[model samples]
Target: MTPETSETTQAPEGHAPSHRADGRRFRWNKVPEITVYFWVIKVLCTTVGETAADLLNEKLGMGLTGVSLLMSALLVAVLVAQFRTRAYRPGVYWLAVALISVVGTLISDNLTDNLGVPLETSTIVFAIGLAVVFAAWYRTERTLSIHHVDTRRRETFYWLAVLFTFALGTAAGDLVAERLDLGYWISAGLFALAIAAVAVAHFALGLNAVWTFWIAYILTRPLGASMGDYLSQPTADGGLGLGTVVTSVLFLAVILGLVIFLAVTRRDVIEQDRITPQVAR
Candidate 1:
């Protein structure tokens, strides 16, 4: 999930009611508060996703298809655990994100490497898929705010959108970094600049928060992927030669440390405020 602003008390019609009959407002958000820690861990998870996928494909002797199947199964299990929860459990939520990242990478790789699909084609397809998801989500929910992800239906849409973002990011990142021959470092730089632009549009130009958040979230996937490639690919391939094993382990460690900190401190949890009901005279 993308980093989000604080939860708002207002709930659109058809959403889970925010105010109880007693007129008390209760916490309803199912995701973490939008904090710096959230972005840091998200990027780290994306980086790990790229490197770990490569690592598994190399070490496990599993073709892209096999690795994709394994990771997808794992993602399904974690998501089941996630959906079963009434609130966000840091470990379970982040595990699902990390696994989804891997599965997303594998999906793009399978399309390109296994099926001979061009990165450009995959990019277009995933982009269209994501657009359709958003359209459907909004049509059904009347709001796309992450703050409103209190119900299972909204959560389902949220994860579906996230999956498409990762797949699109993988395909687009590859298109620019490899197929277009911009190289990983340059590609990373480009995506970083794009994300910066999105931030400016949101904070300075007053773009919609939800749109900006999703845009930045999608951009980070490629940004992280490029950074991973820059670190993990061979020196001859325009990387620092850290190797996928090292990159994956390094990022995963950082993600683990951050998740532990968040879990312990509860710093990322969304707290609900009590609002007294305004009685009609």
Candidate 2:
């Protein structure tokens, strides 16, 4: 996907940065600080989101619509707590993320399985939807950077972009692996290479961090989906046969451990930047 090029600007004046739980000064971004741990945990969350969604759908015997409704309701509850918070609380933010991942997957699954929408169509539609959201967000606030998401409108845009990315990723991943018949391992490797290329372009070739980040963020969902499918699907299906339960449990445990570490250390809290306001205006 091509990254949209737009001039950066901040939200309107009168919005102030927030304080941390420890009373330290910080930005009021509703999301966590971006770091290695952030990306690792994000990927893990995506994997578990895929596997756990599958497990629940199968074990609970809830057809696509039922599972979609249940997860959507749960996501709303989690997002309520997330919206109520003033700062980035790892638990609430990440819980919302994990739930959103599942809900997003279910959304794509419903369109494809229940509604008989084609994967290619779903991928294109979600991509266009995400573009629209980003455009509207930029038109309103003048910046798509998460670092400047201090207002409720920016937070809303952030979550909407995230939801679309998850849905798009789910569709794109299946389009390549299942519809295109590339198999799971090949698909994982392909996405891994793509992510690595994005990193190199950002670090070595001077790509914009915001664009690079959002691009990489979209890719992680598919990467994790492929990895989850590769690990959990049966050997006859070109996977390792680990089963969904085991894969979900393993990834969730890893995510939990990392989140706990982040919570205790508070190392991922983003600092308030003096020049951010100037850019926003």
Candidate 3:
């Protein structure tokens, strides 16, 4: 039987061994290995999420609440499939990311538009939420490295952290762009610079790996969102006049092509051995 069938059989008996003797051997679909393709497709997914959200809300006359509900439902479905997979599946992984990106943005947007929460307040809220997730994750797991995610609990923390990062990034980016009036292109440039600085600090300054990873992760959302806004907004709004549909379609095409390549190559698959941490006997 396939691993999936075996897992289902074991689940009812509470005997499914998702991990090995190593501390790292646990039943969990691990996060994908970091690669150039990972970052490339992540940015593409983020851009698609932003433009797609806007397109559905504006072009389809769905309104913020309607589009948010639609995206949230889709996110739930993608996440369910992601959780069910026994291994890292690139298509499922990226699909989850793209859907979460939309949901995260919508969360912040709803707070601002419907609840009258200021950008500053939303930013602070999301930052605190992210901090709480990190604290809980570290308290339970002893480590927050994405590479170490190999258990159901750790994977739960991982996705929660991801959701918060996207939400936090959305709030922070909007604060800089709208409240601070940086404009879309300028906001994108600022986030790009910030991400570059984080990379330098991590590679050259001996920064903590987990810290660097989360910092970069949060920054990518804003960078991608800004790029999306810059491309999709009307020329009067200082954008390229591409419109959300065109911009979303462009990024979605890239995401789909890259996901297909990763599926065929299995380049992003997380090997079981890599996450199995050695334990003292």
Candidate 4:
């Protein structure tokens, strides 16, 4: 999610509503509030996704097909629970994100590794897939903002877009570092620079908040993937040689700590006030 303190309340018709114990009612967002913690945890989860996918595929001998099936099954179960709940649950929400990230990586891996698809081709395919998802989402919902993900259809579109983003990120990241010979660290640096530029354009140059947020969101996937590869790959492959096990464990630990903090503090929970005029005042 994009980093911000609040969300826009107005939404088109068709959102499901929730009622409190006292019979008071409101429309709630399924996503967490956009904050610094949101971005930090997002990047960490992406890193974990990259490394954990590698660990399971290479170490556990799951192969790309096995891991993809496993992760996709897990993602479906988690998303089922997520959809049933009317509001965001930190554990459930982040779990879905992490699993989706892994599944997304596996999807791209299957195309490139198992099917012998070129990284360049996979990159373009995922990019176009993402664009199509975005187009359909906007056409159906009339808005692409995460803040407006209050309806089931909107939420479905959001997750689809996210999945494509991760797939695109994996393909594009590998294309630059592994396929193009730029190396992991340099690729990471390149993505980092791109994200920084988006941030600058958003804060320093008045870029549209929604556009900037999505741009940064797309960039962070490749950034995190490159970082994960740089840290987890063998030293002979130009990495620090921490290995996937160590890297996955380390990032998972951090993600757990942060999720706990957010859950206890409810800091990242987006209350319904901002999106509902009745509660806004």
TM-score of each: 0.88, 0.88, 0.88, 0.87
Q: Please give, for residues 199-221, the per-residue lDDT of candidate 4 as tens digits.
A: 99999999998788878888888
Off by over 4 Å in 2: 1-27, 273-275, 278-281
Model 2, 52-161: lDDT tens per residue? 89999998998878988998999999888887776778888888999989999999999998899999899999999999999998887788988877556678999999
Per-residue lDDT for 3-115 in model 3, tens only?
Answer: 42123212212124455653223444457788889888888777887888778888779889999998899889988888776667778888999999989988999999989
Off by over 4 Å in 1: 1-27, 274-281
TM-score of 3: 0.88
Superposition-based RMSD of candidate 3 using all C-alpha atoms, in angstroms: 5.0
Q: CA shift at 105, candidate 1, in angstroms?
A: 0.5
Root-mean-square deviation of every model: 6.4, 6.5, 5.0, 6.4
Model 1 Cα shift for residue 280 (angstroms): 24
TM-score of 1: 0.88
Alpha-carbon error at 96 in model 1, in Å? 0.6
Q: How many backbone clashes does candidate 4 have?
A: 1
Question: What value does the lDDT take at residue 96 in candidate 4?
Answer: 93
lDDT of each: 0.84, 0.83, 0.81, 0.82
Model 2 TM-score relative to the real fold: 0.88
Name the runs in model 4 displaced over 4 angstroms.
1-24, 276-281
